[model samples]
Target: MSEALPQHLHSAAYFGEQRDFWWNHDYVALLARRLALDAVIDALDVGCGVGHWGRVLLPHMPRATLIGVDRERAWVAEAAARAAPFAPRATYRVGDASALPFDDASFDLVTCQTVLIHVPDVPAVLREMMRVLRPGGLLLAAEPNNLADAMNVGSARHLAPVDDRLAVVRLQMVCERGKIALGEGDNSVGEVLPGLVAAAGFAEVTCWLSDRAQMLVAPYAAPDQAAMRDDALTHYDNGHCIWSRDDTLRYYLAGGGLADGFERAWSLARDAQRADVEALRAGTYHTAGGGVQHVVAARRPQR
Candidate 1:
């Protein structure tokens, strides 16, 4: 599995861009507040993709330590790259979510973000998280869902190159913002986190919903809409295939079947992209872009 993770992450566009965004943004700082990091001296971020949070937490935790674990090595590499700037203050390694590589009572806090939905055994993963933290340690989890709205699909061929181009543009923009690309995995957060965390024997847990997405594109403004469209398609195709075993990701990437179905639909994608951009420019998409943020927090029993 370790040998394969690198290919999955590097070739997989989904993680690549997310790592870029995490490294570039303050998303980690925002995450720590939910975890109450000021009180946590050491933290283990389970399934810490690309380890962006480590950099943010290192400075905030003062003399504390931070470690990140992930199934994907390239992501670990990306996380390492981001953490390198922070030096000995932070470190990350390739580790399994189902069975973490750590000793009992190894950490003061265990954090995982949006990882429950992706793993095969949620309870097992939670148990592993619980096992590593000292008694009274904090458990912080935030997993967001991917709900799609105002989305349209169209063929990449037949229509004028501009229209085919626009179809890819809208798909990429909407999916990226929703983090729909990251996936809800297979189940809803409402159904997954509470039951799993409770079963792991956490005494207390808190939940939160967040909605924060803001991006739009009008195809007409792009100088080479065609080139941009191809890039978007390639990225969407590559990313979709890597993280998901779902045939849909592989199907679109394959490209043979979709062209037949959406030949007439290309124009609709352009229309969708144009309308969304216009609404965004007119300040009409405020309600449309945001979605719920689900956060689950737990406190371990006092030792």
Candidate 2:
């Protein structure tokens, strides 16, 4: 029998409408110019979840044809369906990032968004991406230091006790360490991606911070804000944060957190979540939203 997929594999919570606001079109256009995408005709998107990253980049590459690959068959199907509008110019298939099913030097551009963080061996995936990219081809990756979000101060938590806030940060830090230890990948892998790309033998490496901020203020009327609010509410209603309670507990235990302290940590987190939700409902919730996504770009050395 086939092994069951991970619980987070096909989660709608992540691929929801809020993803559309990830990049500002003008910012993408600026990146396109900087990367000289005008000369790129064939591009590959590895770990292309629902093809969002590819779709976002396609408009900026007027002559490019996109081929997206994902390990999950369901995401491949969804990506293919989502690429319908670009039919002849875009395609999706089931493939792993670490072992991409394509020939060497096949694409002029190879990229992924929030993909490296989930792979057990980021370097292996980078090698594969470089292998499929033509000499002189561009390799772009977007990953984030997600752990930083734990330190963000929201209106609801502004007056929270320092110890309580520290507990939240401690919980996230432990979970991140455990996640990496368990081979589940790093949640904040973006901080070192530039060095990784350079070490992987890619030349002329460069990095930039994503301009979009997920700021949610009173009224929550903007489409993106509304989506964010709804997503949070759904997760809160389900009694979890981004990851389910079970997943968090597993990570905590793996990361060296004592079993006895799990309940207290979890309870603190739940209380914070509840406070945020109540504040949102009362039109009093807001945050500076210092999300830390990094975009790293490099090129395969010309042979």
| Predicted model with the maximum lDDT | 2
> Which residue pairs collide in model 1, if any?
50-79, 209-293, 210-293
TM-score per candidate, chains pooled: 0.63, 0.95
lDDT of 1 at 297: 78
Candidate 1 regions exceeding 4 Å error are 1-7, 16-35, 148-187, 215-246, 249-288
- Across 21-95, the per-residue lDDT of candidate 1 in tens digits comes to 322135555656656677777789888887645654576676677889988777777677777767676778999
lDDT of 2 by residue, 34-56 (tens): 99987789999999988899999
RMSD of 1: 8.5
lDDT of every predicted structure (CA atoms): 0.57, 0.88
